[model samples]
Target chain A: MSTVVDQPVARAARRRPGALSLGLSRGALELKQFARTRPYLIFTLLFPVLIVLIFGAAFHGDAGGGVSWTQYFVTGMIASGLLATGFQNLAIQIPIERSRGVLKRLVGTPMPRSAYFIGKIVMVLVVSAISTAILLAMAVAFYGLALPDTATKWFTFAWVSLLGVTACTLLGIAYSSLARTGRAAPSMTTPVALVLQFISGVFFVYTGLPGWMQQIAAFFPLKWIAQGLRSVFLPEEFAAREVAHSWELGRVALVLAAWCVAGLILCLLTFRWTDKD
Target chain B: MKTLIRIFRRERAIVDAVTENLAISVRGLRKAYGRTVAVDGLDLAIPRGEVFALLGPNGAGKTTTVEILEGFRRADGGEVRVLGTDPRNATPAWRSRVGIVLQSTGEFEELTVAEVVHHFARYYAGADDPDKVIDRVGLTEKRDARAEKLSGGQKRRLDVALGIIGRPELLFLDEPTTGFDPEARREFWGLIRDLAAAGTTILLTTHYLDEAEALADRVGVIARGRMVALATPAELGDRRNAMATVSWQGPNGPESERTNAPTAVVAALAERFGGEVPGLTVTRPTLEDVYLAMIDKNAISKEEAA
Candidate 1:
């Protein structure tokens, strides 16, 4: 055995390109793992669409403020889908990974911590994008809703969706720090997500909520994302149902961007790469 | 005889070089959780290419020391250098040169052994071929099996494969064979031997004294957050010169004596019996005996101090 040590081989050479390749591979693996989990895969992709279908069919008449019930509910469900992918999925997954010692194992490796984080963010973006597309398709095909027709409306959808996803994903990562174990993550995050869905108008008409409740919802990203999506897909006059009686596209963008920054800072402060203190 | 001289010269030169350029060096390393100290003013140095085993009872700071060396945790006080750089500030290149096989498997569910290894390979600049690493760990037959489907020992082998795929200059194994069966433990020891043969410096922490005796060129025992003993397994507790025990069967039943000259005692017994003594046996203190004695002494002293 000692003779083998005498060969004097050079140590392995280090390469910078490996980090990016590793991150990409990690993202791919996360996606593959998610897909292999049959229940999670099915629920993540189909739940929002199911909610939209059921609600749109039940509330087929005009939903006041010049918006059809189908259009209104579909827009809300799209927001819900984004929230599910960005916030709920990541909040649960990160804690599970930590508890399982997956994050600790990665920390032990030469893979840069930033690479692991970026890989997770990339997976969140991909899954959210796909889930959003599925919800839109369900809305248009089954609920008789029109797609974003104008270039400006598509543009609004693009930036708003991007900002919303970024904010929720960061928030999710931050929220994961509150969970002590994988088993505790669902209880920690699910109630918060469910509460946000309710007050942010995913399940009910936002305009009909109490004044204080509306003010409470205004502080969160979910409400702004729903409003932003509605502005893109609903008729122009439908903005009358919103606070300030307008789409408030500027405010929506500003609020979402602010939340994105806040979430980033929170995650930076609170997010742990491993379960250990 | 000519080959023997060359090997000796090469080995001596390598040892001299590494002793001058230690792979791991620590001084006054201290860490405390609130009021309880996990590591207390401990000092350690391990030369390159040495398989140094750390032995300790539970919570004796072995894991804490290994964690600090691996850069997984920071010390409250003291200087630590692993591969000539402070682990706290070590860059990605530095990290790439270190490998850690943690006590728990990484549990990369749903991915095959080959896939996980290939994925981890990308994290290093010049990683070993994933297939070769798989075969090296003796997992070629189960290379296609998902990580979650693997048996306990197989998972440990996968952990080692990932740890060495990057060809680390320093490898840390923390109680790596806790759940492994005896056969599996032997297999794991063989893998460790192969890595050491290839000159990968290893810092292994284990509770098993036999394992330390089998694999470590030198062993350090820690107790109460401090190093109680550091020596080669044979030299620990001065076991080489420690009194040996000789036992023999007599007409009455059995007799045993602890003596410095066991061979003399056995000969005297042979003469007295007028033939080979029945059921005579000679034994020295095993590694386990030395280890237990060292730990017990430390515990007693600590209690007295408190």
Candidate 2:
């Protein structure tokens, strides 16, 4: 009986979840349902708008040295909003679904397991794209910040941002495994995001920090993500503060890739199909 | 039923084509949650195409055993098979062949009933029609309603609807009618009976004994992870040969006697009461009586062992 059962499963799994076979129609369905949700709608569209509005208060001409904080604030907002939507939202949403036995139900079906993640990844991308566009609009309208004349900078920015999103999203899935309940996940997301924000120069410049802090913050994908964005929008002819300071696009790409690889591995390692916690 | 089922040509291997076969064949199953032995060397064999009920008190490892069989949890030390597949290493194909209606409802607050069912329908290769499954579970009118908007009983029926939407060979119903009213329970019972008649194997675990008697072809009582008894309703305990308590009113109030030969006892009592034995009763042991006695005996033996 065991051999009879093992043979089919072995044959099926021998070529498990190929690129084409991975995505199911259910993934499209899940994305649609997730997009229509009130919380999802608010987090994806409204929450970022709210965060930008609140931070916009700090960017007024009268505030500080009037260094056009909007230019700097734009990148920070992009970093903050993407992380919040992808990582923070997922951590809480996943636990709630698990608690509701939704995950359990899905595990019992023949639905390709990758379909579950592909749906979330698609939602993250859509939400990130919308948020990025709105942030860019806000930056252009009020801050009057300009971009490179050529399309190369935009292409580089897009690739870097996508890599960062993958890292953040996969890490969110990994962090969600620690949450015991749905309500607890939101609270847990805050501290992790806030701590990363503090160390990764979301609140201040990473250059002013100690060497140890810089070394540590370098490991955080958000730090490179924000830095990578800064390199894109910031003037190429701008005076360099440090002697050896240069934005190596390859390093930025490599770091983001490494983070994504690490995050995906962690997520796969710790994720539970049921509410084992 | 045959004519109605034939209409669903797309539904392949929908019913359990079993002939008095075993749905679940567990051998020496064991599980533990860190020093606490949840299921200690337990075993069960439920027949296919039959409603087999598992009854046990709290902490008797009923849920753990069922979860292990459902492939939700792994057993540490034993081989366990459900619908001919080892549940420890459950696959999508194996999963597609089984259905589970748990007490806790799976809710997607945003999606309407039709949406949720239609979405889940893609998971199985040859699934039942979403509309028909919803209608069968008696939620046809509320097909557009969100799952959370449904009443408690309706929610349970929705759970059942989702569970059976895949057209599973074996269905595990854990306390399916816990919160149902009498009428709702009867309606749920009717749905269960309909599924049973369709040749779908059902393994129901319910605290309600009457529900078991009404649904199960056979019932097994598990105590501390051990199946203490397994038999049909009429054959359980000494139900067939157990002494009938013959009681009758004599000149001195009432007299009672326990006897296997109840006819002879009734004949003798007739002489005392003249033509008819006044207030005569020849009562046999009921299901409840046997159940209580069995459990009580187990408790006493346990205490003695301790």
Candidate 3:
């Protein structure tokens, strides 16, 4: 029974593929699965646009330093969109995957463990980019906002958005380790994200908040990301409304980069592929 | 005595040959969760292309040992090798040769069965054809159906399909048929037999003795974190030498006696009843009976140790 059957099967085991291709396929499958979920699709694509429209219409006057409320609100909602797609969504999705045994099943496979995480990161980036583009398009079409006028401003937008997404996604994966079950994931993640959004100036201007609140907001990546986005889209004179009456682009970049490094270390230490207990 | 000697020689030769091609080997394996010892001083050796069934009661460390072998958990202390590599430090190349069917169903919400199977196929270098594997598991009809829509048995079949799609040389089945109906279980058993026939070594942990008897070439019975017995299904608990029971209708209605020679007892009863002993029957211990006895003996030993 052994000799006759062993030869063919052993010969068939010789063809191993590259991990990159496998990761790409996994990313593609994730995107397809996400597309099929109606509620998540609607929320991720429309929530930011809804926030921009509602806030832009309600606050009709200028925000500060001659920047119209519509422009300020558009940039803030874009930052909020990035946080929603990259951090909040992943923090909830990962724990649900663990509780459902999907992550456990993936761990049992021959796939490289890094490939699984890379696939997830890739999916988050792609989804966030799509949602960000949609939010920008809505802002430009309905709110009379303009796209970044110069290549330098576009470059700044590119790096700032990429760093922000990477940092938030890593933080989300790290935070997912705290969730014990799929049912508990929303309760675990939503309150924290909501608090961060409110305090980091997603819904209001950070400089107008109290001194203590501004100090606290300076520690997180969201505030820096929002400030960076404002520098890209708002008028140059609007920098007067920021802290110390300067754009502080260098400080924004440095803080987001530091958060990216810290979030990566936290993710490496805390992210669990399965529910071991 | 001559037959016994020949059988002993044959078994030794088989062991010697298998030792050179062991798919899984363990020595003095120990694992504990905080204060509870799950596997203690456990030893095992499974040969290539052989289906080895590990039988035990709940919390007997069967699952823990299998998880360690599958590289899902690290052992506290032991020498362990699966597919000639230490699972604790196994590379992705080494993992490609091993397949695992876990006890719980894997949930891939909103993903079609074909999509999930096809995605997993890309993970392995020389995976089998996903459509063919789907057909083999009898899920071809539901290939495009979402995973959440599958029945319990269908979900199990999908698990098997994924486990085998890699064309793994060593497959781990952890209670693969736990929720299967009778017919589904028989079908699943047939699928396992086909894999074994194709020279895929299988390490199975199951609570069902009937499954062990039907599928395993050798069965290891574990209890209280230790292997109490290891033998072929027919030879477990010395079932062949164990006394059988003779029963018949006597003057007192029904009579039964335990004896080494049931044929002799039945003959005496026939003579006592003139020509025929009404309702005469001879029965040997079933696999379940021997298994229960072994468990009881192990429990007593554990109590004595404590």
Candidate 4:
């Protein structure tokens, strides 16, 4: 029974595909899976838009600096949408995948581990972009919100969204380690997400927030995300109504950039494919 | 003891000469979870194209040992190799040559059977045709069905399809048929035999003694994180040479005797009866009986040591 064939030579001759192409393929599969999950669609994409409409209806007067409450809330909704799709979604989804053995199975495969993350990051980007576009459309149709008048302001919007999404996605991956099971994931993550929104002026006026609350929100990316978006969507004089007394675009870029770095570090330190022994 | 020493020396000599023919090799493997020793100084060697079964009770370190070989966990101390490469230093090429049918996986409820298989195929450089692999596992009729909708046996077949799609030289089956019905188990055994015939080195871990006896070319019994016995199923614990029990219907009722020469005993009984021995039967210790004896003896010896 020693009919051992020397298959190593033959198998080694075959070439492995590059990680980037495989990552893209994984991304496509992730999108297909996401589309079929109804709960993810309803909560991640539509739930924030629903909140924006309710808040828009409740506050009819101008918030300050001639920016109507609806417009102010629209900008806040975009920031909140990015956080929900990137942070909230991934924090819950990674734990669920780990609990279901998906991540452990992938760990044993020949697939590059980086490709898995790339696929997830790609999914978050696509979902965030779609939700952002929907919020923008709703703002235009219902709130009489004006588009950014210059390419520079559009550039600001692009960087802010990209930085905010990247930071939140990394943080989500890190936080998923705290959830031991899929059943516990939502209960663990939702409260933190809600607290960030409440404190970061997503559901209220930033200038009206108390000093201690404003100071606390300054440490997080969501605050900077909303402030940056407001700079793009609101008139130039609207800066006076901001707590900073200026647009503070430089500080916004700096704070969000810092979060991206911190989040990546945390993800590297805490990420796991399975429960600890 | 002499035969064991000779066998050990022969295996050690082979290890020094050519490791290419050995699909898996481990020496002095050790692992611990805090103070609990999971695997302690265990050694194993499997030659190429052999189906070897690891039999043990739950928490006997079977999972710890397999996980170490699969590179899912690091060993505290040992030399381990799979497919001629250290799993600790395993590369993508090394990973591509090995397949693992995990004890439980594929909750791909949203994806169809074909989609799940096709998706996994992309990870391997020398993958088999997904459709043909699916058909080989006897899931052709349910190729388009969602994974969650498949019955337990069908789900296991899908797991097998994914395990073989990579055309692995060595495959690890971790309790592959734990939940299978009798008929499904027979079918799964046939699949294993086919894979073995195709020259795939298979390492099977199972709690079922019959499963090990049916599929494994050689079985290794593990107790308390140590390999207590290694032999072919029929020869384990010297069962083939053990005395047989001959039972017959006597004038009183029934009678039986244990003897090394059962044929002579039967002949004598036949002469006394002037024809045939009524209800005569002969039996030897079954594999299960021998396995339980071995485990029980190991436990008693450990108690004595303590």
Query: All models, DockQ values?
Result: 0.51, 0.25, 0.54, 0.56
Task: Choose 1 or 2, whichever is better by lDDT.
Answer: 1
Most accurate candidate by TM-score: 4
Instruction: For residues A1-277, write the lDDT of model 2, one tens digit per residue.
Output: 1111111111222323432344545446566676767776776677656766676776566212223556766776688777876798788888988877878877777777788888788777777888888888877886777765669888878887888888889988888898987778888888888888877866666666687887888888888888778777766643153213766677878998988888889988999877782
Q: Write the per-residue lDDT of candidate 3 for residues A1-277, one digit (tens) a residue.
A: 4343374265364566667777778888888888998899998888887878788778888887677788887787788878888889989998998888788788888787777777888888899899889888887887778899999999999999999998898888888888988789999888887887788878877887888988898898888899999999998988888887887989988998898888889988888877873
- Over B60-176, each residue of candidate 4 has an lDDT whose tens digit, in order, gives 889999988988888999889788777878788788888988867757877889988998999998988899999899898999998888998889888888888889889999899
**Candidate 4 structure quality by residue, lDDT tens digits, A1-277:** 4465545425535566778878888888888888988887888889988998898878888887788998988899999988888888889989999988888788878999899999988899999999999999999998889999899999999999999899899888888888999889999999988998989988888878899999999999999999999999999999998887887999999998898898889888889987764
lDDT of 4 at A9: 27
DockQ score of candidate 1? 0.51
TM-score of chain B of 3: 0.91
Clashing pairs in 2: none
Question: Who is ahead in lDDT, 3 or 4?
Answer: 4
Please list all clashing residue pairs in model 1, or write none if there are none.
none
Question: Which stretches of model 4 miss by more than 4 angstroms?
Answer: A2-9, A12-14, B1-16, B248-256, B268-279
The lDDT for every candidate, in the order shown, is: 0.86, 0.77, 0.86, 0.88
CAPRI grade, predicted model 4: medium
Q: Per-residue lDDT for B88 in model 4?
A: 76
Q: How far is candidate 2 from the true structure (C-alpha RMSD, Å)?
A: 8.0
Per-residue CA lDDT of model 3 for B115-234, tens digit only, reads 999888887888999999999999999999998899888988989888999899999998889889999999989999999998999889888889998899899999988888999899
Candidate 3 vs candidate 4: the TM-score winner is: 4
